[model samples]
Target: MTGTGALARMQAAFASAVTDGDEAAVTAHLAGDPALARRRLAIYREAIGANRRGALRSAFPVVARLVGEAFFDEAARRLAAVAPPACADLNRYGDGFPAFLSTYPHAEAMRWLADVARLEWAWHEALSAADATGIDFAALAAVPAEEQPALRFSLHPSVRLVRSAWPVLAIWEANQPGRDGTPDRDEGADDVLAWREDGRVRMALLAPPDAAFVEAIGRGTPLEVAAGSEGWDFAPMLVRLAAHGLLAGFAGPQSAG
Candidate 1:
């Protein structure tokens, strides 16, 4: 390999050893100065450790509470080793964790964990996407009747919808502080729409079709198509969006047919 290729190979080996538990390859890659190699690799190991755990802990605080901090830390380590940060921004680190948990043997034992992680990740991402001011109703009202049919609305940055095949909202609620009453061990599913209000993520339960309709709109389906959706009442979808601060305002519009 040329100099650039050789350097690339060295870095790749270094990363693999630090996060992949390949001790033999790690030591070999270090070669002449084992101490220096070990020391240099240690920085990456420490960095991946801190960023993964911190990001996961921030997103899944309640799950951490249920599992306790020490156990959570150990689990976070395993998770980090298997799926370290790919994004430069550590804030985006836990995006894949829910899927990872679903496949992890231990996580299969606690089936609820995957969904909990999903909910947490949604909140984390929604809190970071670009922000928008509250609906500009005045500007919307100014649009002429003829132009109302071409408007499409954008959602607020902090608004997010999480759809799960588990009772994620109940699980989340049972673990919350003031709401930590009796726990429900029932098998159920729910959708949740979360958003930041006054700088905190607020979550509200959503019905299935309502969740589906919003998803359809996000997919660029027209308002009329989304609202008149077959087998689903679109009114409730509107209510949920209004309640969650998801609606920034109309963009282009169509007639209220």
Candidate 2:
């Protein structure tokens, strides 16, 4: 095998040994005395496991805190075993964790835990999302009145909308470092808007109509349809989103031509 091929093979073997407890696959790659090599490989396995667990813990600190260290650690271990990282970047490793938690048998009692995890993941993504420039209001204004309704606006890359039956936003806020207290009402639904602004991740609770409007726009709906029923004032919501840097840009009907 070429050097690159050998390296790839070794990496695959090491991953299988660490993640599956199958040391035989990687045994041939180790040098030195057989016994010492096995012992060192064991150490390496433990370190790799710890790093995976650490990545999970870092991504889902609120979940870890809520479930306690022992429970969270085991869950993390299970997740790593089932859904090993596809890429080397551990920061992007736990996108499926929220779905896993929702179906996790031990987590059934805390029904809201999964939604809270989703919120945290959104916050994490927003923090890491690429920076974007705001929309050109002058360009937007130049569109003729008849063509305005066909315009489709784009949200900032960091914008994420999360709607959950539980009070996820309140739960997330309450679990923040040094914060204390439970949500005032846990049963009510919440429409959360998460996005990055000025290099900080920010989350806000949106009213039902506002959430629907934003969701529609996010789906690439034309301005006319996203505006919903006639006589309902959507101008304020547009202004608010634009003011917050959530509006990235817009494409008119002719742009698709």
Residues 1-257, candidate 2, lDDT per residue (tens digit)?
Answer: 59999899889998788778888878887888978988887888789889988988898888888889999989988888888888899999899899999999999999999999998899899999988878999998899999999999999999999999998887877777887646656666999999999999999998889999999998889999999997678888899999999999999998864
Writing each residue's lDDT as its tens digit, candidate 1 over 20-132 gives 74556657756678778777778877776777788788888877876788877888887787777788788888777788778878656678788888888878877777777
Per-model RMSD to reference: 4.3, 1.8
Cα misplacement distance, residue 81 of candidate 1 (Å)? 3.7
TM-score of each: 0.75, 0.93
Alpha-carbon deviation at 150 in model 1, angstroms: 6.0
